[model samples]
Target: MTTRNIESTDAAGTVRVTWAAANARRLARQGLTAPVDGGPAAVTGAMVGAHAQVLSAAELSVALRLDGGATRESVRTALWEDGSLVKTFGPRGTVHLLPSADLPLWTGALSALPAGRNPLPQSVRMSGEETDQVVDAIADALADDDLTVDELTDEIVGRTGTWAGDRVLDAFQTKWPRWRQMTHTAAHRGALCFGPNRGRKVTYTNPHRLLPGFTPLAGPAALAGLVERHLYAYGPATPQHFAKWLATPVRWAAELFDRLAAEGRTERVEYEGGPAWVVAGDTDFPAERPAPGIRLLPYFDAFTIASQPRTRLFAGAAYERALAGGQAGNFPVLLIDGVVAGVWHQRRSGKWLDVTVEPLPGTLTAARRAELEEQVERTGEILQGTPRLTVGPVSVGAHA
Candidate 1:
C-alpha cells in the first residue's frame, strides 16, 4: 500500500519526496525568546532577516534555507543560481524571506493591486507620485546618512510637512527599510542600517529596487511562476491556502493554478479525494516512522503553511483552527512525534531564559517525556550553553 493511506508519513517515506522537509520538520521544535542569546534561532532570524552576521552573498543564499552553515561555496551557489532568500514585507505587510529570484515577479504582481491607501489625511498625505518622491528622498538621504527611522522620519516630516509622529515614523523608519531591504539587500549586496549613522541598528536590504531595472516578468509569467513556487514549496494544498499565503484573491489563485497546469509548470495531485497541485519531482513517498515522538518547529516555517487541510500532519481535530489563530502573536510549538502536542513561549530575564509550554490534549508517555528532555538538551547545546535556561508548564490542553 502507498504511504498516503497511512496517517503518519515517516522520515524514510518523506525523504524521497523532498529531503529537506524531513530535517526541517522536527518531532518537536524548541522555543527561545528575546534575550535568549546563542542558538540557531538568532542566526536563522538574522539570515532570514538579511542583516548583521554578514556572509558572502553566495553563502547567504544557502544559509537562509539552512542548507549548510556559512560556506563560500554554498552561499555563492545560492546567490548565483537559486537566488538569495529574500525577506519580503509581504501579505498583510508582514516580513517573509522568500527565494530572491521570485522578487521581481512577486513585486510586479503586488504593484498591480490597488494601493490600500495610506490612512493619513490629505494635508498630511503625499500623492502617489509624491510618496514615491518621499521614498526616493529618504533613500537618497540614507545613501550618505544612515539615520534611524525616528531621525529620518523627523527630517522628512520637517522637510515636507508636520505631524511626523508615530505613523510617519513607522512608515519611514520601520516599514520602509523592511520593504526596501527585501529588494536591495542582495541587489546592492550590502546592508541597510536603522539610522544613517554607522554603528546604529542595521536593517538588511537587497541590492535591487522593486521598480524599473528589476523589470518584473509580464502578468502571465509572473502569476504562473508565483503559483508554481507556492505549490512547489507547499503542496497537496488548496487554492484557499495559496490565496492566504500570497494575499491574492481566491479567484486569482484558482486562475493562476489553472494557468500553471496549462503551462505545465505544475501537476495536480490527490489529497484524499481533493485535487491539489505539486511541482513535479522525482521523489515518491515521505520518510517512514511511527506516529509518536517529539519535535520542535519555528515560527512561519513552510511546514506550517504547506497544506490547508493540516489534518494530514496534525493528529487532532481542532489543531489547525486553534494554532492558526494563536500564530498571529505566538509561535514555538511542541510536537509529539508527528502530531502538534503543545505550544511554548520563551523569554530572557536577566541571566535566566524562561521557557513555558501549554500541552495539547493527550498524555505524553515517560519515554516521550524523556525524548523531550533530550531535545531540550540538544537545543541548549545549540545555544552554546546560554546564560541560563528553564522550561515549564503555563497552561496546556489536548485536542482530542
Candidate 2:
C-alpha cells in the first residue's frame, strides 16, 4: 500500500499532514508520548540503540522511555551486571547501548558498510591481511577474559607481530598503536565489545562471551532487516536521511530502499514536500492533535539524532538556537508537543540539579510552563536529584 491508498489527501495524492500530527505520531512510536512497560533492553531495542558517546545521557535516554521508575543505576546494572545490554561501536562508529539479543543484526549490517577511506598514513596503516590478523587476534585474546587496552595490545602484538603494536597513529596529541584503528571494525564483525570497567580503566571482551553462540547474521538479509527497523523507528524518511543516519553513501541507501520497495516491504509517501519511505502498512497518522507537552531530551538522544526532515522538526527559532552548525543533538532540546522549541542545560551539584531552559520567544504558555516543570522533575528523577528549574537564557555552550 502507498500514500495514494490513504484517505484525506490533496488532488496530487499526497497525504498532506500538519507538522504537529506527524511529530506526534513519531513521538508515540518512539515511546515518548507514554512510557513503555519494559526494561532497558526493550527500550534500547525500540530505539534500535541508544547513543552512548555520553554514557550518562544514554542511560537517561533508556530510563526515560521505561514505565517502571528506572534510573541511570538501572541502566548501568543492565549493562555491567545483568548482561541485558551490550556496549559496542554501532552506527557511525560511535559507542551505543544495544540489546544484547540484537547484536547479530547490528554487527552484520554495520560490517557490511563499504569501507571508509583510511585517514592514517601508509606508514601506520595495516594491510588488509594485517588488519584481519589483528581482528582475529583481538577475538582470540578476549575469548577467555576481558583485557584493558594495554593488555589487549600486548596480546595482539604477541599473536600477530610487533608491527601491530607500533605507536604510530596520531591521536589527540599522542600516538596510538597501529592495530587500535580496527577496534570499531572488530566490534562491527561481532568479535569485540566493552567489558565492565576495571577500576577507572575500560576493558574489551569478545561479544561471544556476552551472548554465547553469538554470530552475526549474513550481510544482505541483515542490512534489509536494519532498513526495516530504521523505517519503523524513524519512518516517512528520505534516502538522504537514512544515509546520514547510517553514515553510508546516499547511493547505497537509495538503492537499498528501492530494493525494499520492489520486494513490497516498504512504500513511498509524500512527507512534508518531498518523497520519503515508510514500512509498508505503517503509515497511520494520529487522529487527535498532540497535547502541548514539553520534554528535555539530553545530548545525542536517539530521537533527536535519528528523526528526519530536520528543517521541519527544528523550525523557526529552533533552527538557530537548538542546533549547532546545522546538526541536531548538539544541545539538549526543549521539545514542545513534538518539535523542538527550545534548548536546555542541566548542571548537577550535590543532590540538587539545576535545569535551565531557553525557549523561543513567545512559545511557552502557562500550561507549557507547568509541563516543563514536570519534565524537569522527571529528568531529576532519572538522574536521582532534586531539580530546580530556571526559565531563562541557558548560557551554556553546545553539549555543555
Candidate 3:
C-alpha cells in the first residue's frame, strides 16, 4: 500500500472518499471479500482479535475468513495446542482470542486505561492497596498450574486475608468473592489467561506460561501503537467511535487523538462529509465499490462490533431489524455487498444444520439468492455439518 493519499481535494489535503469506497477497503482489510490464505492467528491479528465471549461464534468468525478448509477445530487448536492465541480480557473488558505474539501490545495498552467507576458498595469494594494485593496474589496463584474458579478462590483466600474471600460482590443472581472483581484486571496486567477446559469447567492460568518471558509494553507509546492498529482495521473513525469501542471516556480519546495528530502519526480526513482520522499514511481507499455478495456473520463477530458510523452500516430497515436497540452484534446479520441487509439463524441436529435467512423485502435477487445458498453451505462446512437453506422469516429473538 502507498503512503501517499490516493485521491485528495483542496490545498487543506483532506482525502475525499465515499462510504462505498471506504466499505470496500474495510472488507478487504477485514478478510471478508474473500477467504485469506493464512492460519487462524493471522486472521485474528488482522481483525485485532476475535470476540470470544461466545466461543463458538468466535471460532466461526475466524474460520469464515480462511482460504483453506479451516474449521472451528482450527481455532481451538491454536488456543489449546499451538499456543499461538491467548484467550483473555480485551476491548470493553470482554473475552477475546488475541494473538499470543501481540500480548505485549494488548496488555500494555489495556492496563493503561483509566479505571471505570466501581459499582460495588464501599464496604465490599477493595481499596487501591487491597486491589493491588489481590492482583499480586492472583498472579502468583496461577503461575504454576491452571485452576478452576472454586479452586482459584481457595488459593486466593489462602494467599491473601479473609477479607479477599468475603462473598459480598453481587453477580448474576448471586454473590462472588470480593477479589473476583479483579479478574479482568489481572488479565490486563498480563498475569492471567484462559487455560484448556477441565471437563466442562473453565480454567485460568498465567499468560507467562503461554509465551515464555512475556512482558507488557506500557505507556503512551504502546497506546499510540494500538491506535494505529485500530485504524488499520477500522480507520476513518472518530475519537468518539474509538472511545465507544474501547469503553473509555470520549474526552480521553479526544486528547489522545489530538496528540497523535500533533505528532504527525495520524491524519484528519473528511469521511462521507464528517471529520475522522486514519493512520498518517493509510489514506488509500479502494477505487472501486465492493462487488455485490452475501455473507453470514455469527453473533458478536468482531467486524460487526468494531465497524463505525453504525447509522450508515445499519441503514433503513437494518437499523431496527438487524440490531438490538442501538447495539450491534446481538443478532446474527446477513450482509449484502458489505452492509447488513437482513438477519439469519441456524439450528443443528445430528449431521444436518438448518439455516434460515430473512432478507429485506427486495434485497435478494435470483443471483444473490444463489450466493446466499453458497454462503450457507460454507457456514455448514465451518461448523462440520450438512446445511439446508430456508429463505424465510427468522422468528427467533436476539442471541437465541
Candidate 4:
C-alpha cells in the first residue's frame, strides 16, 4: 500500500491547515486518541499490555484527554471504546499503551526479542535455571495478598539464593519484575503500585508482568491486540520510540510495523517530516484549532512524546532542555496557537493552582500577553480552584 507525508501546500512556508482540522486529523489518525467529556456513562476497562504494547497509566490518561480527577470508569472507557490503551512495548522492560485496536497489527509487524538477551553484567546475571526459579518463586508467593513492589522484590531476592551484589540485583530485577507482578495481577486486577518513599500521598499503577501473572494472557493473540492498540494512538513513531517505550529493541518494532503495513492493516502519515504509520485507517487533519483554546498539558502528555521528532511539538531551544536526557524526561509545557511557547510548573496551595510561565526569548504584544494570562486563568478554573499567574523575563523576538 502507498503512504503519504505532508507536502508544502502553499507558496509561503506556512501550511494553511486550520488548527481544528489538524486536531481531528491528529486524533483520528490515532484511533486510540479520545476526548473525555465529563460523564458517567463512558466505557472503560483495564488494559493488560503484552510484550509488544506497553504504556504508562499517565500516558494513557493524557492521550485520552482525561483530567486528573478521571475515575477508573473513565480510563476503562477510553481503553475499551476509543481503544487508546494497548499493551505495547516501552521503556525499562515494561509495556505501555498507544491507541486501541492497533495493538495486534503492531505486534504482528515486529519480531519478538530473542530468548536470552540480558543487559545485566555477567557478575550479577541469573543463570537460566536461577531465573526460572526466581519467577516461579514470585508466582507462588503472590498466590495471595496484594504486595507492594518493594515487598515482592525483597522476597524474590531473599528466596532466590544469596545477595550477590547491589548492582547484580538491580540488573536482575530491573523494572520487569515489578511490571510482571503489576500486570499479572493473577486473579485480581490490582497490582503493586509505586509511591514516593516517605511522607508522600501519591501512587501509580503499572500494567506488566515481567515473570508471570494471576490472570496471564490467554495467548499470543491477546498480546498482539495490545501492541496494535498502542500504534493506533501513538503512531507515525519510529521503531526506536517503540523500543524505548516498550523496553524492547528496535528490530522487534521494525518487524512489527512492516508486517502490519504489508497486511494493509495500517496507514502512514507525514509526522515531523517523516513517514509515520498508524494502525487506524486514513483520517483527516483537524480543520482549525487542534483544540478549543490554550491547554495546560500535564506532565508526560502524548503531545510531549507523540511525534518522533520532539522539535515539532517544542521550540527548538526549549525542546533541547526538555529532552536533554530523552523522551522519558517529561517537562510540563505550555501551548499557544498550536505551538510550544514555554514551559510551566504548578504550585498547589490548598484549592489553588498557580502557574509560573518561563518566557521565551521573544517579545509579546500587550494583547497577546493578556491572552496568555487569560489562558492560565482558565487553566486554574479547570483545576477547580483559585488560580494565580506569574510571568517571567522577556526574550529577543517575543519580548518579555
CA lDDT, every prediction? 0.44, 0.86, 0.89, 0.45
Q: What TM-score goes with each of the models?
A: 0.62, 0.94, 0.97, 0.61
> Candidate 1 on 33-120: residue-level lDDT in tens?
1121232233333322332222322132223334223234443344333444444344444544444545566555554533443564
Candidate 3 residue-wise lDDT, 1-400, digit = tens: 3133245766987777677777777798888987766688899988988998989889999999998488999999999999999999999999999999999999999999989888777788788898888888889999999999999989889988989998998888999998888999999999889999999999999999988897899669879999998988898889998999999999999999999999999998888687889999778877677674888999988888888888888989999999998899999999998999999999999999999999988998997888898999899999999999998999999873
Query: Tens digit of lDDT per residue, candidate 2, span 1-400?
Result: 1122245455744564445556676687678888866689988888889999888889888998887478899899999988999999999999999999999999999999988777877787788899899999999999999999999999999999999999998889998999999999999999899998899999999999889998899998899899999888887788898999988899988998899989989877777776788888777777665664777889898898888778888988799998999887889998887888888899999999999999899889986778788889889999999999998998999863
C-alpha positional error of residue 229 in candidate 1 after TM-score superposition, expressed in Å: 2.2
**What's model 4's overall lDDT?**
0.45
In model 4, where do residues sit more than 4 Å from their true spots? 1-24, 27-34, 37-64, 67-91, 94-119, 153-227, 238-241, 268-274, 287-291, 325-329, 349-352, 362-385, 393-400
The lDDT of model 2 is: 0.86
In candidate 1 the C-alpha lDDT for residue 315 amounts to 48
